[model samples]
Target chain A: MDHSGISVLFEGTNFERLLGGLWVTVKIAAVALIVGLILGIILGVLRTFKNRPLRVLLRLYLEFFRIVPTVVLLFLFYYILPRQLNFNLPGDQLATLVFALWVAAEMSDIVRGALISVPQHQRESGKAIGLNRYQLYRYVLIPQAISLEIPATINLATRVIKTTSLLMLISVMDVINIGQQIIEANNHTHPTGVFWVYGLIFLFYFLIDYPLSWWAKRLEKKRLERANG
Target chain B: MKKKSFTRIIAAVSVFAALLLVLTGCGNAKKSSSQSNNPSSVQQIKKNGTIRIAVFGDLPPYGWVNKDGKRVGYDVTLAHQVAKDLGVKVKFVQVNANNRVDALNSNKVDLVLANFTVTPERKQVIDFAKPYMKVSVGVVSPKNKAITKASQLKGKNLIVTKGTTAENYFTSKQPNVNLLKFDSKTQQFNALKNGRGVALADDNSYLYAWSKDNPSYTVGIKSIGPKSYISPAVKKGNKSLLNWTNKEINKLTKQRFFVKDYNTQLKPYFGKEVKPSDIVLPVK
Candidate 1:
């Protein structure tokens, strides 16, 4: 009614509150991404080793995380599993764990793709120079494979941030939740403020995600040029 | 390259579809997926010297955490009264709408005092006591061109909260109305204010509060569909708690307890926009 709906987001502690919510979202996503990258590389390495049971297990892990929805996994790990396992798992910690696992499964596939894309001759040349398995990975395979993975990984980071929006459903107070809170707090004065509040939220996400996406494209171009050279 | 992108799009669409199904609970993984039949009855609660009552952690007026970070709302004040009458300390378990039924059936809480509306589907699983408040779908629109009847909104865009009685009523009974469904009431009102829809439909109690705040809009259609009541739900067949809650509700209604509760707990948040008799069940 006042036509100052957008001002509501900038009013009082509402802006600061929304920023805090974004901090929570980014903090959780960064932890998950870091952990996912580490586990992903490990699994991607393990994927190369042709062991039957281990392969079967890896396949199952990938499929389980990939196939089952993240929302279900959150419920399973957060609520149901703790009761069955007879232990206490806090909601934020469990949310991070689920997101970490999901990111790991996703990143591992990228790892597999990048590693596979590395020409077989690169391995032969490394071996011809008498590089051991560890040194070969450190110097030749990993360095080359990383270029392909970096852009994809950055893209996945944005995806991870987007998915963390779901954290609030489990009552985790992510950025979206904070927007809702601000709207609720000002529901009386700015009943129409939800439009601007959520619009700001969308802008916050776009601001974070768009730059990373642009950076990813630039990195991909540089990597392709380097590869062709 | 064209064929390859087409396949990828198909894959992405199917995965999205699967997520939609699972998220909407078609996979039988409902928020209230617990199949427990246990309901902590009055005797069990009193013997334990505490009564566990589930309430909303964020829905103000009915139930929500106040500025002091303490849970206090309309339902909460009544919960305190219920516990005091039963002579037991109260434990408030925070629950959203999705988990209220599960919290009760899983024996995590003895009673659910959230602004839970009575529905035939919910009645099959959980036993509802006598209602303490009345509600119906109300549509709010800009004052200049208000939607005064359900027929006026027959073919227009109407915003409603997903999973609410209004959504159910429109989708089932009035199929012609195009619904712009959102997740929360705040969003629904915001959608209407932003001109996404001609009117927004939700519980009349909250709609009145919203209309009062945003004077440019009005609840042109204050009531729609059959009248509904908000009630406490216990696990099915928990006769002791059910009967006790019914009697407790009846006594409170007779003594006009909720009116006082409304004056103190809800009035501040709702302001003068909402009246005690408007929300509280009438003495009969």
Candidate 2:
């Protein structure tokens, strides 16, 4: 309710700094999402192969990432990796890589689920039409699988955006970190600044995620309508 | 029907926003009016019958949570003494380096004795009582890669706890050094021990004390910047509380209260390698 605290956001470079931080968050999430999508598709497709050992290996890889906390993973890559490999890795780069690996694991599961959800008869029908395995997947299985995967992948993108907040802990100067710095600097002047500053950050994240969520819901509705009709 | 749903959603969002503003406004109104009405008079604290003091919840020897779950440290002890002098019950609110000033300014705590160092930037926001301790920023590193001079940090990775004087020093004075900021003293030291950085820059007292227990590291750089004083902070206009705090500090200094605190709480960690006088501020 104190406009004084809320006003601090617009003063001088404070709002600009927050925007810069948001850009960093968006950039990291975008890079991680793109990388995750590519890796996920490859891993997901491989996971569907009939070979037991290969499938088990992919399953283990997915489980490992799912089991570990993102913060610990970020630390391992940022601090431990540099020591072990004898190289300097920036915190932001390591954060991006860790988030990408995490997203890849989640996305792979989504991909595998979507692929498996395609009825077996569809693939069999492709074969009955004299289509080879590659053409069958390209013409029939992949197209149907894509429709199922899109909504979930969009959801995953929103999750990635939210998870970028964790990068602040590793000192990446993301939106959350900048917000903290701004509050730290100005909280004394406007005693109620913590509420307003954090509320704005909440808004920033909501603005980014709400549209994606809406799109996912719309896609789900369309998919349901097509299925029902 | 679609347009109706859309309008409903907008209405819901606006109502939520208005509710948030009202809630925040009420909270802010309560805090501001309390301080503004009495601004800095010790009478308010006396009337409340409790003096709320903020001290660090981590950062051992200065302030920390002990195994018994009690907040105990030199600063906490000093705060207790100040409360006793004021004839009010002591209420300890845990704060860290980053939030201590905010806690004071917001009236969340009546005084901040969390090993708060007086800095020019901070002085603008809050008033400090007479200093009770003197500290200097220093560098700690493994013996093999010890840093002795500022020049030695050139192109090297330096770890510092966020919001500390060490971070401020490195940012302005040794800008060439690659600085890694962690949230706490524990994390900063852990990063140093893990070889994530070549050297750790922090208060000399803490670095010296930690190095004594960990033989692999040494306090290679005794003092990086000018000595800074640790004092109790209050809201900027709280003259009565500020004056009382300064007078109590002067009295405590005369009584050598911190010297005793050093002997009991700090000596065990720092040992004779650091003297009681080295860390305690003089009475003058």
Candidate 3:
């Protein structure tokens, strides 16, 4: 409500900083979604392998990431991974990498489910034509599996965007980080400006993730239409 | 049917590849953001006639939101003065402890006033102005089971805000103390109040402030370990700004402006327990 302190947010480099941070959030989400999809497909396919060891290992990987909290996983990246694994990455890059790995693990289960949902008759028909295993997957099974996974994939992508805000803990200057920066800078003079500022931040995130949600839903409807037609 | 499916597969892969390219381009664009040196180049600031400042908004008493939803605290007080002394219209920017250094280095802020502590490790990365507040490390405990000595903290759960001097000191010296560190003091205080830990360790001023609002909690001890000073921080190699700030501190110290500052900003939380002289360091 205090227009004076909160108004600074709209003017000069402060607003630019917020946009910069939003860009970081977008970058992290995009990178993580892509990496997650690729890794998830590999893991998902491995889960179907006849070898008991590989399937079991893939299942364990899927379970571990699913059970652990994303923030704790992020901590593992920020603190333990570098010291133990010697992966000395910058904070923002580390956040993107870790979130991608987490998303991939979660997404693997979605991929596995979608793959299983593809009818056995389809694979049988491909085999009747003497199609190679790789060609069968590339031509017949994977595309249908992905189309089924689209809705879940969009859900997972939004989750990555929401979770990227947690990277503020490790000092990654994302959108929430900019909000914190603005609040701190103005607190002394504005004293009551944080509510408006943080309130506006909620709006900023809503503006981004909500549209993605709508687009995903619209795409889901189109897929349903094509399936019916 | 087989040809149609193969075409679909190729299309999907190509679309996926295009998405990857666009995202990679986005990442590169962010990483290579234009290096705007306006704030860092203080020479330009002198010409512009304004200095930008960044402080924490959610940190109470030091920097936090008040009831009407505005940021207010001790750091904000000095920040306004520093800008005034610079003869530039002050532009306050919000930042937290985590983003303080980056905000400064990125030229988003001219100075950092976010309850920043003067630590040797941090001094290496950023130049610090003269210390304005005396910040001694202390602990808060439930009145029922108070801890009066630093040695009492050994082997007990000590909740501290992560990335603070409290965590640093305890981790370095009191290794046996089980640290349940949180990112915010609100959480640390909650842990202490909820009986999740025996005590919470942080700056004396914060403990004193907490004790005032909640009489049930008491600060069992005063200061422990090597004393720490709180000061505004600026980016390294800003000698012009640093020297100007040092002179301003000297003027404020001579004018008893610091006493006024302490009385206005800190006295409410401190009450009559801590003498003014105890807080006011000898001008050196």
The number of the candidate with the highest DockQ is: 1
- The deviation in Å at residue B111 for candidate 3 is 18
Chain A TM value for model 3: 0.91
Report the lDDT tens digits of candidate 3 across residue range B1-284: 66567556645764785598567656644443442422344565666787877877656566654434344667777777876776677766666566677666655577888888788889998999888777788888888888888888788889999888789989998899999989897788778888989988888877786687677878887788788787878888888778777787788878877787778767876766666665666666
The better-scoring model by TM-score among 1 and 3 is 1
DockQ of 2: 0.02
- Each prediction's whole-model lDDT (CA): 0.80, 0.79, 0.75
C-alpha RMSD (angstroms) for model 1? 10.4
* Model 1 lDDT, residue B105, Cα: 54
lDDT of 1 by residue, B1-284 (tens): 54356446544754774486355443333322343323276877787799988887667778764433456778999899999999999987666778777655545578989999898999998999999988888888999998888899888999999988889989999999999999986688778878999999888887777676677888888788878989999988899899999999999999999999989887775556467877888888
**Which portions of model 2 miss their true places by more than 4 Å?**
A1-3, B1-284
Regions of model 1 farther than 4 Å from truth:
A10-12, A75-88, A128-139, A214-218, B1-60, B64-72, B76-96, B103-111, B127-131, B136-227, B234-257, B265-278, B281-284
lDDT of 3 by residue, A1-229 (tens): 3457667576446677777788998898898888878878866765665669767877887888889988788767665554343334556787877877788788879888988889999989999998866778878888988889888888888878888888876657788876775775565456566787778778888888898899889889998999999
lDDT of 2 by residue, B137-235 (tens): 989889887787889889989999988889998898878999999999778888998999999999899787778778788887877778999888998
RMSD of each: 10.4, 19.8, 10.5
